[model samples]
Target: MNAGALVLVVVQVAVMVVLSPLLVGVMRQVRARMEGRAGAGVLQPWRDLRKLLGKETLQADGTSWVMAAGPVVLLGSSALVCALVPLVGTTTFPLVPDDLFVVVSVLLLGTVALALVGLDAGSAFGGMGSSRHMTIAALVEPTVLVSVYALSIPVGSSALSAIVEARIADPASIASPVSLLALVALSVAVLAETGRMPVDNPSTHLELTMIHEAMVLESSGRDLAWLELGSWLRLGALLGLVGSLLVPWGIAGDVTVPALAVGVLALALKLGVIGAGLAAGEVFLAKLRLFRVPELLAGSFVLAFLAVTASYLVVQG
Candidate 1:
């Protein structure tokens, strides 16, 4: 790889490592303020992670190797997603022909790993949570693939770099009606995948309503910390992908000092806006019942399908 690509990869990885916790912190602070409570500092998540890392790990007697490997795999997969995505310019791993599809599938792999680990613990809540998680994943994954494919159709390639390059080469194309519809579809998929409100409640701890958190109920200390960090990193990477494709303005194509600086600033700004919007949505909306999730995801899938059809019609015309 060229130095520019190498530098971009390094910078993107560093940004994911540092900024993941900060993004979580910002969301918590925004949610607190919106709910009329004293907000935690933006560094609160960092402090929590540090404390968790310093504490000792405890495992249940029935836990299997899958339980032990789940967190590592989760973190590794998220890091891989970060590397595959075009954060600064393009991925250093752009030569990997199926990076976009791999990015989507790796997320599913991590989720399945965690679900199996949750079941291995043999806790009632863990099993229940895993079941719900699988259900949600089943509903969400197809929408995510369809939505991404809608964006990929115009570019004629499923690789993330090609999508971003296509957007940058013809910036006006993103404002088309089909792209707008796909953006809306993908935005809903993002919420569902990220455990945001109107899909799943991130702050809820009750076993009856918990989807993501219940699966991690048995995790403590370092394991829990890594899982939480992985979630945050995944969130940022998803939002970054959306920004790169739908809002490619200010993204740097080269890794010169100036370009890298601009890329960092653009990433930060986009994430900030996304974080605030998530917080607002959480404050304003209520979580859907478990049964309603499928309908929501199905709606997104239909919209995405429409986007693909519309794009074809426009191109043909």
Candidate 2:
């Protein structure tokens, strides 16, 4: 990578790491306000992370190295996704083109890592959470792939940056039925992938309803810190993606100082708006039953499939 690309990647990753916790805080605050409670200030997640890092991680007997390695792997994977996705700018390494399949594969690595962590915990709750998680993943992943594939069809390439650039270059495309359908489907997939409401409530700890929380019940201190931060970062990055696709403006086309500044400001604004809106929407939503979750995901897949067919028809017409 050239110096410009390298600098852009570093900035994107740093921005993501710093803003992710705040995004989570904003979401929580929004939810709290909507629920008529005085929320902890938006800095609560950062405060929680500081406290967690200072504490020592405790390991239970019979737990293997995964208990130690899993969080690190998950965090590392999240960071990698931050680097690969076009959050700040479209400039990327020649060797790392931000291909759609590659990005999805990297995300799956974290998903599998988290699932293994849950299973390695050797607790019944952990096992149950992992099972539910995998079931959701099986349904959600295909929707993500197919939805993006529909988007990629218009660009004739799978690099996410290229797709974003194409939409920016042709803003009218963003309003097309194909784009609308694919984006909606992709948004639903993101909610499921990120453990948001109506799929798995992030704030819930009820054993019967827990999917993400159950996996980390055995982790504490720095281990838990990594898990939380990793998940937050992933959610932020994906939100940025959805924001960029929906409104592909202000993302730097060239890695110059002014453009980069605009990119950062735009990214922050987009994330905050989306986070607050998502939190508000969730307040009125109910979590679907475990069996119904698949039906919802399947419905998204059909939208994605229709989008792909529409895209091909548009091209051939």
Candidate 3:
């Protein structure tokens, strides 16, 4: 990659790394306020990460190397995908990494890696969480894929940069019913996939109410720090992905400094909006029964299918 491209990549990762925890904190604070209570400041997640890092490591007995390596691998995979997500730049030669297939693969890799960590822990709670997580993941993945595919139909390419470029070139495509339905499906997938409320509660530790929390019950110290930080980064990356695909505004183009700056600003604005919506959902909605989670994702899959069908009809018309 050219030095400019390398620099842009670094900037993209750095921006997400610095802002990811802040987004989580914002969501929590917003939820607290909506529930009529005082909440931690938006810097709470940063403070929590620092606390985790300074604490000592505590590895579980009988756990495999996969457990020990899982947190770093999960975080590393998330960071890798963030670099190619087109969060800042639209496209750069020698490193125009915007393949939709790669994005989905990396995301699944992170999910599976975390699942391995949970299963390797040898704890009953961990095993239970891993199984539940995988079940929902299986249902959510297809919905996510179909939603993006529906969005990319107009562009004739699954490359995120190409899709964004096409959308920018014809902004009206954003308002199509197909796009709207696909986005709705994607919203459900994001909430379920990210372990947000009404799917799984990020803040809850109740064993009966845990899906993601159960998986991480065995990690402590820096391992937990990496996992926690990675969760934040994952949320940020997903939000950025949605913004690039659906919002597609102010993204850097032509590698200009001013354009990149605007892209960063726009990216933050989009994440803020997503975080607020998440907070509101958490406050207003209750977590579903484990069996009912499938119904939620299944509904998303149907919407995604309709989105694809509608896109073909609309595009043809």
Candidate 4:
């Protein structure tokens, strides 16, 4: 409600929209170079979006309004997430604090919207993808909550902005066992939730192997554009969350023009570094089998549980 928070919200949304596609392109370029291929430039995702937006959208018969509504819902939810999560600044919204549960719920809204869109498509691949997507979602969401809850323990607040601010205030806590364990757990969950390697391949279309791609086979034109952009924003924002939590530096505690400018640069740097690292790491990895993904997620859950226990023990000690 204050000027700082209002300005930060606008800035967060604008930066997420503008940076997400570029982040995706950077990841792709990284992977391409690793694989010894001529890479599409970092501006490629923007080019693709422009092309998709200009094409006509097609819908099949007997599909409900979900076909039309789902993409909008997904994109809207992702944009809201960018606005709510303190990606570049720590100014908290008066009405809706950046609580971990609230952020995860908004993310779930987008996930559900995408699943419904897949189911509405009425193809075998779509149904299969939806089932798989929901299965992963069921596992990933709990890890996200529990891991972030661990981070919230020391600060005694679930608001992400507060947690980040606390980390900035106390640099030593960033190196604590609780913080490291929880961050690792959350990072794995982020990879799974965003359709990254070892969970789902963002670039693959092999019918038996694809999860996110299978669901979107039926969408075209602007519909597809919305879906792609929404997914990219989710990835960008979650990566920003990880970056902010892992290194809570340069985020403006009190929003000023100079501070905001520094925050934006810091965020862009973090996203690029993390995206490139992820891509480079994925080069040496293979997508896990659908059945094996549960084990990986379950392992992350155990890490989160340990982090929670460690946090409590540390507090007691």
Candidate 5:
């Protein structure tokens, strides 16, 4: 990587580290306000992180190396996925064919690692949560992959950089019916992937309904801190990927300082809109029952399939 790329990478990573908690805080505050309560400040997640870090970590009895290593691996994988995503106009690293597939796989890897660790601790809730998590993942992953592939069709490559570059090259393509359909499908996938409402409720702590939180109930102190931060970072990364693919406007294709700054601002604006939409959706919709999740995801799959079919027809026409 060149100096400019290196700088951009470092900035993006630092931004993810700092801004992840704020993103979580924003979601929490918005959710609270929607429910008619005076919401906590956007800095609340940061405060929670600080409190967790200051506490002592306790391990479960008979927990193996896998349990201890899970959080670190999860955090590392989250960071790696964030780095691989073309968040700010261009990728810091060179584009690799089929890398987008790898990105999705890495996310699954992290999720599985956390689930295993949860089960390793011998907590009934943890094991139950892990089982539920894998079930959701098995259903959700294909929808995400197919939906993203639908969007990638017009660009003729699965590489995120290629997709972004194609969209930038022809901004009008975003208005095409196929593109619109793909965006809709991807939007649903995003909500599902991020544990948003009508799919998974981020705020729910009830063991019967909780999937993500139940797995982490045994985690404490710095370990919990890392897991929480990783979740936020993963959210931001997924949002950034969607933005890059669907709304490539105002992204800087070059590496100049001014261009980088513009890219960053544009990215922030896109994320802000996404965050608001998520907040609004959560406000309006109730969480779906665990059994109903398959139907929701299957709907996304059909939409994605239609999107791909529509794109092919439009291109051929």
Candidate 6:
């Protein structure tokens, strides 16, 4: 990579790492305020992570190499995505694989790593979390895969850079019915993937209602810190994808300071809108019973399928 691209890569990764937790905190604060309680400050997640890093870690009994290795792999995968995603610039890092499929696989790889860690921990809560998480994951995959491909159909390429570049060049590329439906599918995806709102509550300690938290109940100190940071970073990366792929205006297409500043402002605006919507939904909607999650995801699957069909029909007609 040239010096400019290298700088952007570092800047984007640092921004993501520093700001992801703030997004989570904002959501929490907003939800708390809506419920008539004074919320913690938006820097609460930052404070929690800082404290966790200083404390000692405790490992569960009978945990194998998987327990030790899992967080490293999980954090690595999340970091890889932060590096790969087109946050402010419409290009992939040089020498990094540029396909969206590669990006999706890396995401799924993180999920699999977490599942392994949960099983390796040998806690009933961990196993329950793993099973529910995997089940939701399997149902959600088709919607994600199809929605991405549907968005790509207009650009005629699955490369992440190409899709971003195409939409940046042709602003009308996102105005189609396919794009609209695909956006809804992705909206549903954001909730499930981020463990937010009606899908899963991030702040809850209830074992019967939690999916993501249960898996990490045994982690303490630095290990828990990695998981918490990884989760927020993962959400940030995915939200970046939603912005870059669906609403790609104002992203930098070249190495210019002015363009990069515009890109950062644009992304912040988009993520802010998304975070507010999620917080409001949390306040208004009730959590789905576990059995009904599949039904909700199935509806998302149909929307994604329709999005793909609509994209093809637009071309064919």
TM-scores, each model vs. reference: 0.96, 0.98, 0.96, 0.98, 0.94, 0.95
Best by lDDT: 4
Residue lDDT tens for model 1, 1-317: 56667778778889988887888889899989888889988899999999999999899987988877898898888887787788777635445653567888989988887788678799999999899888888887887788778888888888878788888989888888788888888888888887888877888868888888888998988888888888889999888888787788777876688888888889888888888777877787988988888998999989989998988888722
Candidate 5, residues 1-317, lDDT tens digits: the string is 56666676677777777777777777778778888889889899999999999999898888877766888888888888777777775745554433668888989988898898779889899999899888878877887788778778877788877778888988888788887787778778777776778877888868888888888888888888888888888889888887877789877777777887888888787877778677876788988988999898888879888988887788722
Q: How accurate is candidate 6 locally (lDDT)?
A: 0.82
The number of clashing residue pairs in model 1 is 0
Q: Rate the local accuracy (lDDT) of all candidates.
A: 0.83, 0.92, 0.86, 0.93, 0.80, 0.82
Q: Rank all candidate structures by their lDDT, best first, as comma-separated numbers.
A: 4, 2, 3, 1, 6, 5
> CA RMSD for every model?
1.5, 1.1, 1.5, 1.1, 1.8, 1.7
lDDT, residue 198, model 1:
88
> What CA RMSD would candidate 4 show?
1.1
Better of 5 and 6 by lDDT: 6
lDDT (Cα, tens digit) per residue for candidate 4, span 1-317:
48779899999999999999999999999999999999989999999999999999999777888988889999999999999888889988688778999999999999999999999969988889999999999999999999999999889899999999999999999999999999999999999999999999988869778899988888889999999999999999999999999989999888899999999999999999999999999999998988999999999999999999999998622
Q: Which stretches in model 2 have alpha-carbon errors above 4 Å?
A: 315-317
Query: What TM-score does candidate 4 get on C-alpha atoms?
Result: 0.98
As for lDDT, the candidate ahead, 4 or 5, is 4
- TM-score for candidate 5, residues paired by index: 0.94
TM-score of 1: 0.96
**Residue 211 of candidate 4: its Cα lDDT?**
91
Candidate 3, which segments miss by more than 4 Å at Cα? 92-96
- Give each model's clash number: 0, 0, 0, 0, 0, 0
Worst 10 contiguous positions by lDDT, candidate 5 = 89-98
- What RMSD value applies to candidate 3? 1.5
Kindly give the stretch of ten consecutive residues in candidate 1 with the minimal lDDT sum. Answer: 90-99
Q: Which regions of candidate 4 are displaced past 4 Å?
A: none
